[model samples]
Target chain A: MTPFDTRGLKRRRFKDKIFTSIVWGLTFSCLLVVFIILFYIFKKGIGSINWALFTQGPKPVGELGGGISNAIVGSLMVVVVAALFAIPMGVSVGIYLADNRGKKWAERVAIAVDVLQGIPSIVIGIVIYIWIVKPVGSFSSLSGSVALAIMMLPPIIKNTEETLVLIPNTLKEASLGLGASYFKTTMKILLPTGIGGIFGGCIIGIARITGEVAPLLFTAFGNPAMVKSIFKPVDTVPKVIFAYASSPYDDWRRIAWGGSLILVVFIILLNAIIKLFERKWKVQF
Target chain B: MKNRWRILENKIFVRWLSISAILTMVLLLMFFLTLLVSSWPAIKANGFSFLWSKNWDPVNSHFGMLPFLIGTLITSFLALLISAPFSIAAALFLGEFYPKGVIPNIFRNVIDLLAAIPSVVYGFWGLYTIAPLISHLQQKMHLQASGLGIFTASIVLSIMLIPYSVSLIRQVISMTPTPLKEAAYALGSTRREVITKVIIPSNISGISAGFLLSLGRALGETMAVTILIGNAPELPHSIFSPSYTMASVIANEFTEAVDEIHTGSLIEIGLLLFVVTTIINLIGRLIIKRAIA
Candidate 1:
């Protein structure tokens, strides 16, 4: 090659190198922010995660040491109730969408699901307050579950639909060829085949709502004492974290840290389990 | 008898599926109607002037949403500005430079973890760590800073939104046809040239859709913004000035809004937020659909 061509080549190569380095630098900085946040949480929270954190109720104001057992139970109760309400309906919608892909009504439902997924959790809180809390004349865990259940439906329905869609149509055809009814075909064949993915979706939905604090703020309206009845207001982990972290007391802040750590750990575990499920139970078809 | 039973069960199952499918649309309609009905009092009280008036005195029974509207737009857009570059770079790194391997996988997983961290936890971290840092910086600069303001909240929000754009952009980038890249390379183009000229230009619609979706996320983000934005009611003079957003105001006051007008105004804000986010998301989804098609 001539010298002029060599000069142009060097210039382009240098530009490429500079651009590549910039991309790498920016990417690492983004990753660094993640690590910094993670490290900070673990450092601040490790000292507060003792046995009492899991076993005892919160101490009264001005007290030094207490746990978040009540919050833990409340979170479980709220999230479980949300899952129970969302899973069946979400999965049913999923099956319908998968079965009737191009139908006009099904298409509208699918779009509605997308829109519902995009609605802010805080708005859901307001709607539930007007619909359930105001009508019942009380903030209740049931209202909180309703709010969370709304948030949970999109993910669950999308996952189940996508999973069932991937299963070969031949399976359905063969099941019908065996003279099995549609209900029997769905229950005995389609559901079992897509159970892994459906369960993964449910877990993701649960994880999403578990970390949500907005809807619960006004609906489940926190209580200081542990409450057993779903009609009674309950204090959830996220809600408690919000309450305690904003308070002036150092002890409450510490309890909030403990609660934060518990939530982070639980969500991380849920995500890991999803990955495991995806890998181990991936259908070969 | 067995055949008859199977036929009846089949009919019931199909009917149930259709009803459940329709329930989703019903839920959406209910959300809009409930917000409208609840906010009617405020709409009647304030009328169209509520959209532009700056006054927000609750004691005087006056409520205007302009300041909150401006605050929400500022923070969400500022967050989008801050995160867009980092997300695009990270997406390119993962989708092009390292499409598959241990490193990319780990990076993807870490980003997902970032997304999973509870918003309240992020808010707490911002309150203690980021806010103090900002306060110290402001002190050194001799600026009036409570360390909690639009800028601080935007920083926290940018971090929270990065994972969303990164994941979406990476998917779009990876879906860029292999032949297109090969064609650019065959024409004696370098990797950077191919990216700038071929990949990005071709996939601009999808990339913007990713950003639009992330903007929607930032718009409705409640807990983190509430904790960090200092809850000021007035219009912010600068990024350092504290202000409130539509979502944060609802979160801060809805529970304790004793006055009928106060409660109505808060619900009005929720209605506005719902409409804005819904529009943004619909536009983003439309863009994504077109790009995919």
Candidate 2:
């Protein structure tokens, strides 16, 4: 080959090199920020997560004896309660949307679900506060869960509907061809196949609701101690973090960071669990 | 008779589930109506100036939202400005340039990981890490107040939105027919020509829609922004000036609002935000769908 083609090749190779460099630059830049944030949180917060932090309620602003045990438990209580109320309703709606006989109505329903999903989280919080809390005139865990449940609903419903619809048409036809009815075909053939996607949805929905602070603020009115009644004022990790981070007390601020870190890890773990479950489902279901 | 019963039972199940599905939509619509009606009281008092005023003082009877509204628009527009080009480039590389190997896998995981990070942690990062970076810039600029203002907040907000924009754009770009690119190459056109002329024109609407949708996200974002922006409320023209957004005001001042009008004003501010963001998203969806159609 002549030097003319060689020069052209060189130019192309040069451009390629520049492009790869940019890509690598972007990848490392993103990782650098993410890792730095995670490390800073761990460095600032993890040391304080001792038995006292978990067992005691709240320490005097400086010395450390009391823990955020109550808030942690309270956070779990609301999240669990919200999940309990939201999942069944969301899943049922998802199933209906996915398995409906009327295609036109299904599309309309899908549009509505999308609109609901787009509504801001704080708006949902305010609406729930008005509908549930104002009537009762108290901030309670139930009210908090209700708000969170509504927040959690749209994702699960949308994901479940989408995942179920993605099932191979042949699978459904096969079940029906083998004398199975529409309901049986869906319950067994469609849903089982979509369980992985549904699980992914569930994980994300839970993660979303767990980090939510604005909604919980109006609904739960942060309590200092672990309250047993679901209808009583409750503390959540996010609420604690928000309240304590801005507080005048240094100890409260440290605990707030610690709480924030715990939430970050929990979210990361849940994501990993969803991926791992998806992988396993790719094998079995 | 038994066969007839079996057919009827199956139909009933189908009917019931469809009804349930329809019900979810109906209920959600009802909830939206409730929100509009419930907030009408606040809306009536504030009038349309609910959006134009900036003074958010609660002690005095003065209620201005121009600052928060401007703040929301400024931060969102800034985020779109910063994130759009990078996301488009990254998406192009992922869709066109990158060999399907470790790099793409890493990129995919990074994108997913970015979305997975909690917003609160993003807030903390803005506060501890990013804010310090801004403070350094402020010193360099010889500014008295910290330069951790709207611009710094916008940077953080942009970082937060890149993942959503990138993946969605990548998906749209990948859906383009390959032959168009092949034809461009066959005509002795370059990769840049193929992308800028062929792929982009085909998917311009989706690309723009993606940016606008993420802008909507930026408008609603509170946690990260609240930490970075110096939360001073006023009608400042410079990005370096500290400001408050509609959302941060709702989050920060909702409880501390002293009286009934103060609380109502805050709610009025939120309603304005909700209306703006919802309209942006709705228009985006319609535009993108129209493009595809």
Candidate 3:
């Protein structure tokens, strides 16, 4: 028998061990980073999360305590308005893309959606500023919501299309066979079955735009005082954080941390809800 | 009568859906056209020099995108360089080493959470934590620095990019056929050998496409880069030098720009960013399609 090369075998084994260790080490480091960031955010922001942080408006400069009530209200207003605009349109387009998958126009629209998803938020801000804010002669929460609605469209559409695509064609065939119209088949059969995913997509879309500061930077314009009208400038949590965190005032910076904590908690809740929905509503067929 | 009413309703519904779908395309076109119209004055005045020139004096009415362009390219490429290896390793670990287990699921969730964290939050965190560390390191090295510079921005950007690239790579890696892997194992190959030789070699196209998609993402990231990049419009002379990316410059200047030419120039930069990102994303998407095919 030929002599076996024990040294070569040993070297290969050693190399494999080294590579595996490196992979595990790098992965653990990535996970460690997530923990570190979460830890720091919670630590820094936890103390500042109190009744006043959600109840009152911003205090004047150099003041010790104030809340982001204006920002909180503004965020809700803008995001809810954006959802109102985006959800219907996004779902409609999603349906169109899924129903007419192979058509030339549908393919073009799908590509456009993908490209739209890639456009930077700041650029969206600029376009919206030119299109809405400039023509209206003012920056308003309405304009901000419009920009955000645009940003929200791609994900909502993509998700709805994908979710609908996964549903068996038998459902649609059966619906049509029962003498239901295309509209009825879609509304009665397809949408309800996929509602969990569509709703999850809407929540994800909300989470995405909720923390967006760029498009709002130009369109919302960041009002410090409380705003009641959608046509007026409004403060959002992310915009407030951006303004406050960059400021030199220690008090404002504290408020910024408080705002960050709220934002993070909100996002985490949204994600958890998405996970829950995905698991609960997963259709077997 | 009921059948006729149903047909009418279906036609209306289908028509509305088609209109909505067409509006998505219209919106994209509007973005391009509005940017073109808003930036026309600068485009006309500066001509092609707007692209290659480095001069950006608002008072003198001179605006050029070269420095920011270079800054954007450098920071993005640097971020890709820093992130690619680590993300690849992490992906292999999760998708191959622990492909179906509690450990891999936890790791996957962590990575997804990484992507879910807001970019502004990342910027805020980096400004306080990573920026100070980089500043201290630079001072120790006797280099003039604020800790908020290209390198600092790239580091934070790389962290953000990792979730994206890792998810993409892990997806393609997991999709690597089981039979091929088993064949390598049957041939007395070590796991590392199976990965490096059989799996990676076959999935090279998908892997490259994943990285390309991440690079496209890195190019357009604004908030983290804006907060950490120090917003200097000058060309960076060193890795530690403060600089402006195309997106950051727009975010920093668009609201404050008072001059007509300045506003136009800023819009022009936005136009440039839109075009470049669209092209990169298209190429990445094309590559992904080809790889899948």
Candidate 4:
């Protein structure tokens, strides 16, 4: 190579090293922020998580000792109800989208799902308020679950569609060749084959809604007492955190911290499970 | 006889599943229609002036969404400005510098964890830790107002946006054709030069798609902003001034809105948020489509 070319190459190499170092620095800092946020929550919240914090309902104002048992139960009830309503519908839609790829109705449903996914959570709260809360004449846990179910649909649908679509068409062709009907093939073979991914999708959907507070703000409409009925208003972990943290009470804010910790842990665990499933299932064509 | 019955059962089952699938579209239409119908009362009352008017008084029966609209735009844009560069750089590091093995994998996992961190938890952290830290800095700078304002919210938002945008952009960058990068390196071009001259330029659409998607998310974000944005109703004079976003307003007021006008106006705000975020998301989706094409 010519001297000029060699010199130019050397200059570019030095510049690239500096630039690469800068990029590495940026990545390091970004990771640091994520860790800091997680560490901050754990540090601030750990002290607040006592045994009573799990066992009893929140105490009255100015009270020293209480827990988020009501919020815990309320959150679980809402999430379970949401999953029950959303999973079948979402999976069906996913099946439709993947099975009928490039079809007009499928395209329309896909667009609708995307738009629904993009709608602000607070707006869903309002729509559910008008749809269920007004018609039923009260804010209830049922309404909140419906709102969350709407929010949960997109994740489940998207994931299931992607998963099922990855199943080779030859599998379906073979099933048909063996005299299995379309419904029988899909239900018996396809769904089972993609069950891991579908389960991950459901978990993702559930995780997505677990900490959602805005939809429950006007829908479930937080209750101080733990009500056994889904038809009654309920206090969720997120709603409780929002309500307490905003107030001036010291103990309430600590309770909020405890609730935040629970929520963070729950989400992390759900995500980890999804990751494990994806790795373990490592599908090969 | 059993075989014929099975055939009929399969047909009926398929029909039922198809109906369930189509219900998604119907549900989405109903959601949009409900918002429009609910907001009609406020829309009719305010007319076009609602878009311009700054007054949001419920007692006096006046409502305008200007402050919230501006607040949402400013905070989201500010967040984008702070996060985009860092996300791009991180994407470059992961996609180009360390495409595999321990370091990149660790970074990827951390990003996923960040994405899974609940919005309320972020809000809690912002309210307790970041807000106090910002307030302390402001005190040192002798700035007026507490640190719980547009700036604090934007910082928190930027932090949240990084993991999301990085994941998207990194996917884009990593998917760049191998031959393209190889050709650049074959020409004595350095890694940075290959990234700037080849990979990023080729994948601009995907990068922008990621950016727009993140902007959409920041715009609709509620819990974090509601907790950190100070929830002041007035138009913000500065980043340090307390403000409210469209999402925050709906979140903060929808429950307490007693008057029909108040409720209607809040719903109207929700409608506006729905429309803006939908447009942004659609554009992002379109850009991703184009990138794939």
Candidate of highest lDDT: 1
Give per-residue CA lDDT, model 1, range B1-293, as digits (tens): 97888899999999999999988999898889999999998899889989989889998988888889999999999999999999999999999999999989999898888888999999999999989998888889788869999989999999999898999899889889999999999999999999999989999999999999999999999999999999999999988889999999999989889988889999999998899888988899888877766
- The better-scoring model by lDDT among 1 and 4 is 1
Q: In CAPRI terms, where does candidate 2 land?
A: acceptable
Q: What is each candidate's DockQ, to 2 decimals?
A: 0.88, 0.43, 0.81, 0.77
- Report the interface RMSD that candidate 1 achieves against the true structure, in angstroms: 0.8
lDDT of 4 by residue, B1-293 (tens): 98998899988878876898778878877877898998898899989889889888888999988999899999999999999889999988888788899868878898778888888878888887889888998888788748799999999999888888998888888889999999998997878889999999999989999999999999999999999998888899888888999999988888788988889888888888888888998889878766755
The DockQ for candidate 1, computed on C-alphas, is 0.88
Query: Candidates ranked by DockQ, best first?
Result: 1, 3, 4, 2
What lDDT tens digits, residue by residue, belong to model 3 across residues B1-293? 98899999999999999999999999989899999999998889889988889988888888888889999999999999998888999999888888888878878888888877788989999999999999999999899859989999999999999988998888888888899999999999999999999989999988998998888788888888999998888888899999999989888888899978899989998898888888877887777766655
Model 3, residue A281: what's the lDDT?
83
lDDT of 1 by residue, A167-235 (tens): 998999999999999999999999999999999999999999999999998899898788888999999
Task: Please list all clashing residue pairs in model 4, or write none if there are none.
Answer: none
Candidate 3 global TM-score = 0.98
C-alpha lDDT values of all predictions: 0.92, 0.77, 0.90, 0.89
> What is the docking quality class of candidate 4?
medium
Fraction of true A-B contacts recovered by candidate 2: 0.35
The local lDDT score (0 to 100) that residue A186 gets in candidate 3 is: 96
Q: Which model, 2 or 3, shows the larger TM-score? A: 3
Q: Write the per-residue lDDT of candidate 4 for residues A1-285, one digit (tens) a residue.
A: 554666777888889889988998888888888889889888888999999988899898887989999999999999999999999889988988888889888888888888888888888898999999998899999999999999999999988898899999899899999999988899998899898888999999999999899899989999989889999999999989888887898889888888888899999999999989998874458
Write the residue-wise lDDT of candidate 2 on B1-293 in tens digits: 98888789889877777676777777666665766676676667667776676666676767778888788788889888987767887777676677378878677666666676666667766766777777788778777557568988888888888788887777778777889889988987667667778989989988888787788788878776776777888875688778888888777787666666777777666666667676777777777666554
**Better candidate number, 2 or 3, judged by DockQ:** 3
Sorted on lDDT, best first, the list reads 1, 3, 4, 2
